[model samples]
Target: MSPRSPREISVLVPPDLAPLYPDDPSRIGPYLVLGRLGQGATGTVYAAVDTASDSPGDRLVVVKVLTSPELDSADAYPALEQRLRALSNTDPTRVVVPLTFDSDANPPWVSMPYLAGERLSHYVTRRGGLGTGKLIALATGLAEGLSALHTRGVAHGSLRPSEVLLESHGPHIMECAVAASAERMRGAGATWLSPERFRGGTATPAADVFAWGAVVAFAGTGRVPFGPGEPEEIAERAAEGSFDLDGLPKGLLPVVGRALDPDPERRPSLREVIGAVIAVWQAENAGEDGATGSPGRDELAHVLEREWQAVEPPARVPQVIRLEGRMSNHRPGRALFLAGSVVVALTLVGGGVWGLARAFGPEEDGALAAADTAGERSSSESPSPEDDPLTMVVRFDPAEQESPATGPWLYTPVEPEGELVRGQGVPTHAEWAERWEAAGEPGLAVIDPEAEVLCAKFCAAPQHLFIDEEGRGTWELTGGDFVDYLSWGPVVIVEVTFAEEAREGDDTPREIVRVTELFTD
Candidate 1:
């Protein structure tokens, strides 16, 4: 890690977007990773900016991960999703919730707003101990935040000092790093986990309350209540109640002590914790003109501003990046098989379609396909073909022939200009204007091979109007060719130009595809 302050570390050390160590993923979902925010027992968090966000400040998000429904038992996925989404319904004022997530992704990830502040530990270490007023404020805000989570049926499974951010207003809690399928003992480090958790208990709202006490205690004094060591030693000390509650405010002692009770049941509920913290705040500020129950309105806000100014995270995103593409484990590959519209380095057929691969072709389970990692799903934005197609493969039918077919059937996603398809040799805007005088050229949709099934009722090839054998698409004798009727004599490869109607249409242009072109059978 860089020697910069925790907040300053968000600024990218590299000038342009550098590859975050070679081991880091180039892309997660759609978001490109500019730099890694931090890593913990759960997973790595990448700092990425959402350029699409209307407000610049609201764009920074830390993509860690969401619940992995695929890995969960069938009965467990729904419940896990409910819990993760509950993070959103949380009180935004006191909780930084998950902003985006892809449940179908492997090792599913959820992105959360990287709120503006330093870790709680960073603030306590920088300013030494939080004074009585600030401690009461911090305690109240944390308790209320946790209470809100409980209301949504979401327990922040892991609530350590690192999980709390001391912003300008007060402490806001972080999401539980793990997207759990079933409850399990979580994050037992830095002496914040409840004793029940140490002895192997699942995360419960009570466990969260216990962790809250530990975080508050740490803020009051820079020392960990159970002196630092491995998790085992901390658990041992917690059970013995040999706490180092040295500099804690006397008024905060009772409530904090109740919250940290060794037994989960004995620990105060978050509501009780909130009321207790408020009572302490009242006692500490006796004889003041403050209202009875409002602990955080002005008093806490004032304490935060005076004591805990938000340490700006200098997170710089070069352009910005997006990150995911999973619908589910059952069909994680389904999206890949469909028209990704991604350009790949595949050998083109007759210099026509750029990439025609089984990966982008069929939608069957366990069929892995190759695709570029950095970008996904482009509508009009799919990259232009590497080179303008000089030769096209198609099945052609004349305007005089009776065949119902739709599009100019270019193999690449880009539809060629009407003039080029008509063999006019790259006409200019004015040239097109003169040619289009007879008819308006409606834009042709680039037919996606992935989207188009191989077996179709009709197809059209551009007719080059060659006097030689090539111009006659005739299974002909003239053009005996409707693509469906030409199963007899060998299917041939031929190139051609657009008909007058294909070039100028008030509505949609005609579609012409060659299952195989006929040089002339």
Candidate 2:
């Protein structure tokens, strides 16, 4: 027989027909168990209806019953249950938060709002790869969910296609840290595991970043970057950086590439990834007009909503179960298992991973010193005024000393003879405005000819070197090609020029400028 295609094996099994063991509960807490939804090595999930609700049939929820021996500890269930309750109440749109849970039950169970949608894996298999627009929308939602988890010091250790549910509103992230713990205890691994995880490193925010990259790759190409294989083999490939990106969209390559980098320290933060992806989307659609031209948060959300509504609704409403029961006596043989689970969970949530700490160091002191040294070296190696016609050496004014309030140091323009102009501090926008008025707002000049110019043409603009009081700027130079040079030195030389048209804001009309180039050591 020929090998089965993804479409052939991708037939989704209905929840009603999912196998239900005789021991499965008929009822959990305030919910009536309806049918088995799915089962993993560590847990069994079920479709259920809220019996306590006056309108019981209006909506359904899911109940996950953990079977791992590691969760038998007296404290484990309570801690996990409390955390689930907090998450469910915090965000409903981005994540599938638990409505309630009963850690005290014989098999601790969590109830979450039943998502009436297919798993991301199923979607990819059935529909093939998604377009760039939809992928951007999905990535944005997942990034937001991860950001929320990270903000609370929680890491979605297992972020993969199976854990992402595509709903009408947006993509919902399910089974976060707790599921990761369960998988670890069961000795079941995923291809999306970061290289650090394969090396026995603890899970962290960076791990999520790696997994997020993998998820994005899978969604865009309809295949995992490392390809399908035994878990160990896939992990080894990932560690060796053997993934392929042939089918991934060009615009998404940068964000996904940095995310899947073997070194976790090199991966962009979740927030950074979000911004980068959004910028890519905006750039791709730059020719469009009005709201459609630029992809903002609202635009991404709208895309998600539209994609979600296009899919066929599930046959049955999803369910949630509020588990209710008392904690069973601890088993002597389960002590070690429970302890191991606790340690892993704590390591992921508390940011206690040994490799991460060592990679970044306990503090940034060494990194800062290294950056300063590199900056100095770059200055020394720069071309002399005689060799480079455009080269201009500048210094800070001796009389106007730089204070903490003055921000970063500024250099003065030097002549071909190596002559120094009067030193002056890099001024703030307010100070620049004052200087502009003092100089009678003279036309932009290359050389001051007289005293050293305090704030030169580009430097004097609000959007160039200084930000407004609201901490907003027309351009952001944090990531992508702009910040790549920052790794070599502490300072970057950027050339800013005024735009053809000015932007009228609520407070005042401001001169907008474009950042033409960024040069680093």
Candidate 3:
């Protein structure tokens, strides 16, 4: 539903602002109206609780009464409710799935889990633009939601900041099935309407893409992409290509720009949009090990915490422990001596050679071994490659490579603890050489100085890799040249073959040749 005009008093607020109104219904089928959540052109949503449930502190739900003349018909309610139920059963990752619906009531209404959060418009208004990671998370969720609907031949005709609810987990698309048909030509901001919709075309999936871009622009800039004006004025401005995307993150600009393309046919599909967003997110959060995965619920929580702190500074907890009685006033002059003694004791007990081996061995090797063991145990229980939910594949173009021509490039993770690494446009030849020399040039891989260097802005795309039991690596890129690489960020992957030095416990005497592949996906 469209957001209420800025001049009107907002009924959406914390519990304090959601008091019951005289005209509001006390009961909606099995649900008891707790208070008014918000009112829109189509209907008024109320905070509700299931009256039949005996449990105390029952989870709240929201019931939207279909008061609009166009949507209140008996025949329309059944079809709409059925569509919503089907959409809800399709997936729960992208949208706020509907709980139930009542078509037999005096006024048909639909129930959905009550998300304790504000609309995207209010969030941007209160907190300004979201950080890159949080924005990516939101974009990913919304795109997935749209993808789910589009796959089922349903379109979210109205997709705007007002239709998005920002919650602790991630942003959730609201009023999916019902709103698509009910509010196809009304109850949406002008800036979010696609050119096709304005020209009397039906709301297609592409139109939803256009609206998605506009909403994203609004989130990033706290202003509509087509500038501010009346609905008609804004539509005209959009037709004239007057929208500005200056404030969007560099990594997201390309995707958003393409989505906002004046020609609806030029806009990328919802799945493609999601891939671009993921690519940017992976680059930003990639760890030193070069393994990449989608951000988990924990990351979303972190974003929520930051937003919360921005609106209301967290109260500082008082320090309960005092150092006065726990330690002597005078600093210990023999601190160095004590530390030295401990080191000497360790060396003596472990042996000088063994101690040196511990210090010199690759620190990550042990962790990798542990991870391998755990992965082996879980692999059997995990879905097969075909069924794997996380597997993502995109075409790789060798001609788009961006690194310099040099000998011996090293591959490393973006963050020490990160699983995804950029493998496409990172560590130019010069950078690789510096790292190689510093690491004592242990690998057999040679970089050829005379090799041609291919560089392009769209060289690096986010990828996911799978390592087989034999330690062979395979990977898939997530975006392409048509996708904006600048907004997606840069990454590189390199493979090195080297002789691993034998340690004291090894049965083999010395060097054993091994192939090591480094990737950012």
Candidate 2 accuracy as lDDT? 0.51
Tens digits of per-residue lDDT for model 2, 229-286: 5677888888887888888889888889899999888999987998888887777666
lDDT of 1: 0.48
How close is each model in CA RMSD to the real structure?
A: 26.6, 26.1, 26.8
lDDT string for model 3 (453-487, tens) is: 12121121111124434322322111111122211
Model 3: residue 150 alpha-carbon error in angstroms = 2.4
Per-residue lDDT of 326-354 in model 1, one digit per residue for the tens? 33222132122111111111121121111
Best by TM-score: 2
Ranking by lDDT: 2, 3, 1
Report every candidate's CA lDDT.
0.48, 0.51, 0.49
* Comparison by lDDT, 2 against 3, better one: 2
Each candidate structure's count of clashing pairs: 33, 14, 28
Residue 77 deviation, candidate 3, in Å?
A: 3.9
Error of 3 at 442 (Å): 75
Off by over 4 Å in 2: 1-20, 56-59, 69-75, 177-188, 292-296, 315-521
- Give RMSD (Å) of candidate 3 vs. truth: 26.8
Quote the positional error of residue 415 for candidate 2 in Å.
Answer: 90
Ranking by TM-score: 2, 1, 3
**Displacement of the residue 140 alpha carbon in candidate 2, Å:** 1.2
